[model samples]
Target: MPPRPRTSRRTRRSARAYAILLPAVAATVALAGCASTVSLEHAEDAAAVECADVVVRLPDVVAEQAERQTDAQGTGAWGDPAAVLLRCGVPTPGPTEDRCVTVDGVDWVIDESDAPRYRFTTYGRTPAVEVVVDNEIVSGTTAITDLANAVSVIPADGACTTVTDPADVTP
Candidate 1:
């Protein structure tokens, strides 16, 4: 019988490398496709120049949640199930009874009516930015703080002031 040719050690190593690497590459591609696209609506001023700036400046992660792809412009999302969502260009909110908190130098009007799911809208910034956070998965404070730099690009025209402040009172 004719002798079979022996494979070289270098060839064997290359084959083994591919054997281990092929599956890893395939799994990564599969998992990436498995991530569903987040659906969102653009705000009234979504096309504003300031909104584009905010969207471009958004961080890759917020509150430990990795950012996700969104279906709309001037919008951002994070987490597998979307623990935090941001929309730039929402109508700038006016004085309200809702609780307001400042993170960094930016002020946010917090709506806690929904409890664990809270809506935070940037106050006093033109072409306002709005962020909705699922407090159960990530702290709203952390998410808002992470976003402060991006939202700050809009520039503040106003701020959250107490009704008791005499100078802030408007007739």
Candidate 2:
């Protein structure tokens, strides 16, 4: 019986061909049109910015506000000054159609200038809670917009205005 010679190169070439061909076939199969569904995870959370106690600092320094007692008037209207007063723990002053309600000497009003609508002034300090998905009530200046993302009411535009004014629109 004669012994057959072992062809080393032939074996090597076939193995290499198989390695290349296998991946091509797999890739085509993966690309073939097919219906499939995938589920994705999402994350959500409320705004965590602090809204109280901290001192408010504004640039383009206004000498008037620095006087401790800033008389914010003509802010157009308080979304519902009455409601804002209630949120600030102000007692009922009297009957009124304006968005503002009276409490003692100073009238309480709602300021919705910044995003995530919020109260500009409180009993003594300004409320600093970041109103997420609401108006951007940054610092004290409120921007005019109709984004509908306002968390409170429409803010009075231009110049200084008090939310206590009945003309102001309250949420």
Candidate 3:
């Protein structure tokens, strides 16, 4: 009887490569099925009715990033890599030099110190909402606009002012 032919060296190497790659591919596929996980710090002041409303009203998609699963309440995140993250009930900020922009009706104080990653906080609302957006992944305005609808639920008590009013200045 003729002896069975031995597998070629190239064939053996190919098989080994495939064996090593198969698990990696499977792991990637499995992770793709699961939503991106976002770790968040829970806010102590987030128990307000307005915060709950904002959370419920948060958009499912922002700047084309689908909302992902977050581990904390009063928090919302978007994008597979979490390009945008929002947290409600943060302590209100006092006077600052940060640039402020109003969208829809909500006032946002923009902090670009980190560049590419921008942090926007509600100006005068109690338990102010804070949104951190990756400008590299999504435009800051777009993220703020998408979240504004939800954040507007919290009424603004005041707004950022660059100049102090003469009437308010004490002699």
Candidate 4:
């Protein structure tokens, strides 16, 4: 065979540079394809302390939704599509006519006005814990039940009552 053509210095340098950059570019693309990061607004200092327990005790999975990374101080998200989202240290809601359910000793006010999605907020807690789940994707009961343990960290000061008259019920 005839003598092989020698590669010029510039050509060799270009090949070396490309070889070094290929892996980095591939890694960046791979990371970008993963579940997007979620960031929530920070809560007040007082609520932040009250939320620490629940945040730390949150389960890795809820209603079959795997936990994902969150940048918020007191928030968590589960599933690639985010079937469940939790925010702690939220403002405590006052008495309302909304339906309430108690799970594992933790009272939750259920809001289903938005069909296919349900919002459950802890009742009577100083700094309430809020959990939003897509009913279409996961069972609302299961998701709330899974979070009961973490929410229990906040003590219950009161609960929902069915008394229609003050005189009919004894304090």
Candidate number with greatest lDDT: 1
> Highest TM-score, which number?
1
Global lDDT of each model?
Answer: 0.93, 0.28, 0.91, 0.86
Question: RMSDs, each prediction?
Answer: 4.9, 21.5, 10.6, 7.7
Query: Candidate 2 on 1-171: residue-level lDDT in tens?
Result: 899877799898999999999999998778542412222111111111211111122111221111111122111112211111112112222332324422332233344455354543322212211211123222223211111122122222212233465567577
Rank order (by lDDT, best first): 1, 3, 4, 2
Estimate, for each residue in 115-144, the C-alpha lDDT of model 1 and write its tens digit.
899999999998888899999999999999
Sliding window of 10 residues with minimal summed lDDT for model 3: 28-37
Question: Which is the winner by TM-score between candidate 1 and candidate 3?
Answer: 1
Q: Summarize candidate 3's per-residue lDDT along 1-171 as a digit string, tens digits.
A: 999999999999999999999999999889867765799997877778889999999999999899998889899999979999999989899988778888888889999999989999999998899999999999989999999889998888998678667899899
Better of 2 and 3 by lDDT: 3
What's the true lDDT of residue 1 in model 3?
A: 100
Worst 10 residues of 2 by lDDT: 80-89
Model 3 clash pairs are: none
TM-score of each: 0.78, 0.17, 0.75, 0.74
C-alpha displacement of 108 in model 2, angstroms? 78
Residue 106 deviation, candidate 1, in Å?
A: 0.5
Question: Model 4 over residues 43-118: C-alpha lDDT tens digits?
Answer: 5533567788888899999988888888888898888788899988878878888898899899999889997999
Order of candidate numbers by TM-score, starting with the best: 1, 3, 4, 2
Candidate 4 residues lying further than 4 Å off, grouped into runs, are: 1-33, 43-47, 163-171
